[model samples]
Target: MTPQWLTSIQTPLASAFYKRCGSKEKAKADERVAVIRDNSQQIVASLRLRRIGGHWLLRALLVDPQRRQQGIALQLLQFVGAQNPEPIWCFPYPHLQSLYHQADYQLVAEAPEPILTAYNVYLNRQPLLLMCCNR
Candidate 1:
């Protein structure tokens, strides 16, 4: 479903969206549509399907801090995976590697330039696992 603010490029949604993903930096929100789940008047979870260069990237997946361990993220990942059978790429934290593996994403030694470049700039110099789902 589309959020009304998402249609406007300069809306507060961009900042709010990245904040939801725990990011302080801005993103190109106009590049793709996001899937979100709301509870009452609050947004609980969200995931975006982004096109970077020629590839589809699963980006900015986040679940509210209060909603962790409830399988929401898994469901969202599955939904995104089912929607596109083509390969999708992501750079997930090392701890989430196994979870993405269960969703059919396998770690890759090499990634596309955009992904690789982004990985290098990821916060805290945190090690990220580059994975791809080749469904």
Candidate 2:
């Protein structure tokens, strides 16, 4: 789902992300999709999606670090989950498992293959668990 707010902010975010990643190669990649929550004031949280397995995949989910445990993350997940209409898969930080599980997602034993990326390397190349939610 192409979010209107994300569509508005995408160019700048892509520019910043390309600079941080140091690569135009991945910046222009069509697979990346950004979803945001805003109330005509500020963005609450944002989730990124990438296509895999002929279905939409949840690639990144970030809540404002300052706004933890206020249901912001789950709200973002729920909103994005509703828009996509396909099973959503996630690779959440291990500590966030219980929280996501409570949101009707099931933890899985292995990471999905198509999502292996440099971000995983930064996360120590550990087996990032998978979780899926169908709504």
Candidate 3:
């Protein structure tokens, strides 16, 4: 089921995600979607799924500050994983490795060229985990 706010979330999603990631530059040029709370008419979370080098690169998952720790991000990850059973890759911050692992994403040592290039540019100096969901 597609969220009703999917079409209108690009700007707000980028804003919220950039705020959390501490880099407005990281939110550029990706296809994104949001999870909206039907009862409250608010977007609870957002994520980007970009096709890079024939693989789905799941990136920039962000939950509303007040909505963190409520399993919203995991739900979004699971939903996307279910929808795209093909290999899905992501570079998650070290702190989020366990969360992604709980969603069935495993650490990957290698990735496609586009993904590897992006990782080298964005996270090579950091302790981010490169993960993938192939189930």
Top candidate, metric TM-score: 3
Residue-wise C-alpha lDDT for candidate 1, range 16-69, written one tens digit per residue: 756866866344645454445464545566656667677787776777787778
For candidate 3, write residues 65-119 as lDDT tens digits: 7778988888888787777768888888778888889988888877778878877
- The C-alpha stretches of model 2 lying farther than 4 A from their native spots are 1-5, 8-11, 14-40, 109-124, 131-135
Q: Total backbone clashes of model 3?
A: 0
TM-score quality measure for candidate 3:
0.75
Per-candidate TM-score against the hidden true structure: 0.71, 0.63, 0.75
Clashing pairs in 3: none
- Score residue 34 of candidate 1 by CA lDDT: 45
Candidate 2: tens digits of C-alpha lDDT, residues 12-130:
56445434434342322464545344455344455566676565666556655655678877766666666677676666677888777876678654544654442355357656654
Sliding window of 10 residues with minimal summed lDDT for model 2: 19-28
Q: What is the C-alpha RMSD of each candidate to the true structure, in Å?
A: 3.9, 5.4, 3.5
In terms of lDDT, the best-performing candidate is 3
Error of 1 at 18 (Å): 4.4
